[model samples]
Target: MFFLKYLPTQSLILNYQEHFPDGAEPKIASRLEMLREASLLLRDLEDFFRAHDFSLTRFLICVILDRADEQGGLQHSEIVERIDVSSPVISRSLKSLIDERFVCVESETEGRRTKRNRLTDAGKARLQSLMPGYYEILLK
Candidate 1:
């Protein structure tokens, strides 16, 4: 999403070469273009999720849990380790999911104090319903 609208990129790169000939990184243009494209893709995904009234964070957490699925589900710490998001955001989203009946917290079979978050049957159904649209956006 970062672009020099007033100046063409080649012009900007040429200007940089004129000013800092030795410091001109040969791959800067390609790197910037890559980053810009990635940013725009992410922006589109965010817009799509919002348009559906769904959260990308919650969706990611669901995906992580689904992939690492066990009867008792994954522990809170395990969820944190899988995702790049901050703990508090994960905590808030995870907690809301429980309230929405999409996820449930249960004790481990062994006598551990740790809590595990499992997706409900309803949750699985919701995930199934969302996947087609999600793939559509990705494939698009």
Candidate 2:
């Protein structure tokens, strides 16, 4: 029942009911379970990165940078929106990346607060290096 929530909302509920006709099916409970599983997986991955002194937040930031627009770059705010993390969280992560030489602020846009973040050579390589292991856990 709890596991059903992890799936896409519409499909998950119907699928769960089909599988477990006798079980109670509640959207809230299902979503909660899904959130729990997602959190668990994130924790597991975070622990994995921590062992190697890598921050998961930074890794996610790097991922966002890799998915740059057609021009191969993105604004910092876009990163925040895409990752669905708070500004402070993204700021902290970006700092880590800047320190590690993985990313840099390429330019300041029209707005005073908006800065375009670009992946440096090292940043691109680092992301590429991490993808295999990241996807291994991610896909699992």
Candidate 3:
């Protein structure tokens, strides 16, 4: 006895019930539609990132660093865990960011080696430059 208040057409609902047989679960269908929409949004974001010569991972790292705690920054291991990327991939991205002067790293030896990363002024600017376009795409 599920009901959809905003169904496009009665005929569409009838067709859906026919296809589904037992009953038409509009909520499940709506959830699936939402997932599809999210996938499309991600695709758009990826395309935008590619056109800007920035990989999504790199952009995400900059964002993470930008929002990191004020105490200092996140360690390499913490970043790896947060992003769910392999150490090698994270290392390569960090190296590229460092080369581009978008990020800085500091190493410490508090019992064990720790490398902390934070965004540079340039990184913040880069992210800021992209935000307008990102927001426009999302709004559309």
Candidate 4:
């Protein structure tokens, strides 16, 4: 069970509680409220990325690629682990990025069979463009 020291979301809690059975636990109701709030925030963030013509996953890949060393790139497994996403999700995002000229596969191999990835100049620029607004939101 998740516990918060202070829950300042009274209206949200009330709304969520109304849908549950009469004797539902307060903890469950509050958890639902928190989940609802998180979902809304995530949706807004996704919409912001979409407005810039990029999905959230693709934007994240650009960030990861941009942070790699000048002469090194991230391997497919590295990206999957760092992003905490499934293989197919990372694969699709990488494919979209490659098609958009935002990312590329480096010829250099990490090990026996690992293919490395790096961001193109276009990807760096795109990330830079979004950074100001992103930072503003975070700072607030």
Candidate 5:
């Protein structure tokens, strides 16, 4: 989301006419409007997730796991790759989800230290519950 909730007014954009070449003004105005609308959309998504006791990150994780092999879910490193976030943050969130009984991990091999993360039945249910609200937020 945009750090500045208060975007510049149209008059302020108009004032930039003197600084730019002739036709560039309209392009600049269009870009600003796009950014402003995108920012508002992101904020709405954030709020909707928060109200449902969920986080976007967690929801993304669930979505990824939903497509993984049923017998074994995605590896931690795989999730990190898919989400493009720091491993520590993924680990922390995974830990929380495990504690909440929303997720489980299985050792990949007898002696291997690696584990795969999978959503428990409860986790799947929770994700299912959130989908409708999430869709409404977008379509509305």
Candidate 6:
């Protein structure tokens, strides 16, 4: 019983091959299949991130912050371009991180409506803690 529950995901993936015919499955896989791969891989990371009080948006914001340009922050517009997420989507994410003291926002010089965002020390620390597990799955 314990063995049944302990099977690794990699093992299950290997076994899924039996359901398909020989040389029939796309070796390179399609875009939809790639999306499926992303979905499955994210499941493990999502559980880990959730333990750290992160949603996918929050986790993605951390990634954005980590890759920010000159100001150690990115403009809201820039973040949307890089992540392909909507402004409202990132707005909610920024709010959560801000409330948690994991990030800060600065009004743009040009206008109050525009804002730049950066990760806080706490956010970086949390990201550091979560990195190893994230890296392990991503590298697989």
Task: Tell me the TM-score of model 5.
Answer: 0.80
Question: Model 5 over residues 16-105: C-alpha lDDT tens digits?
Answer: 789888788678878877887777777888898899877888888888888785758989889999997799988887888889888889
- Model 4 CA lDDT for position 74: 93
Best by lDDT: 5
What is the C-alpha lDDT profile of model 6 across 1-140, one tens digit per residue? 01122223544454677876765345424433566666777776777778766776787778779777356698877878878678899888888888998888887676568778888889888778878877887888
- Once superposed on the true structure, which residue ranges of model 5 sit more than 4 Å away at CA? 3-24
Q: Which regions in candidate 3 have their CA more than 4 angstroms from the true location?
A: 1-24, 109-112
Please give the lDDT score at residue 62 for candidate 6. Answer: 87
Clash tally, candidates in order: 0, 1, 0, 0, 0, 0
TM-score of each: 0.82, 0.68, 0.74, 0.70, 0.80, 0.67
RMSD of each: 3.1, 7.0, 6.5, 6.5, 2.7, 7.0
Give the TM-score (vs. native) of candidate 3. 0.74
The TM-score that candidate 2 achieves is 0.68
Best-to-worst ranking by lDDT: 5, 3, 1, 4, 2, 6
The deviation in Å at residue 124 for candidate 5 is: 0.7
- Provide the overall lDDT of each model, using Cα atoms, as 2-decimal numbers: 0.78, 0.75, 0.80, 0.78, 0.84, 0.73
Give residue 23's lDDT in candidate 2 (0 to 100). Answer: 49
Order the candidate numbers by TM-score, best to worst: 1, 5, 3, 4, 2, 6
lDDT of 1: 0.78
Candidate 4 Cα lDDT to native: 0.78
Give candidate 4 regions above 4 Å deviation. Answer: 1-33, 109-113
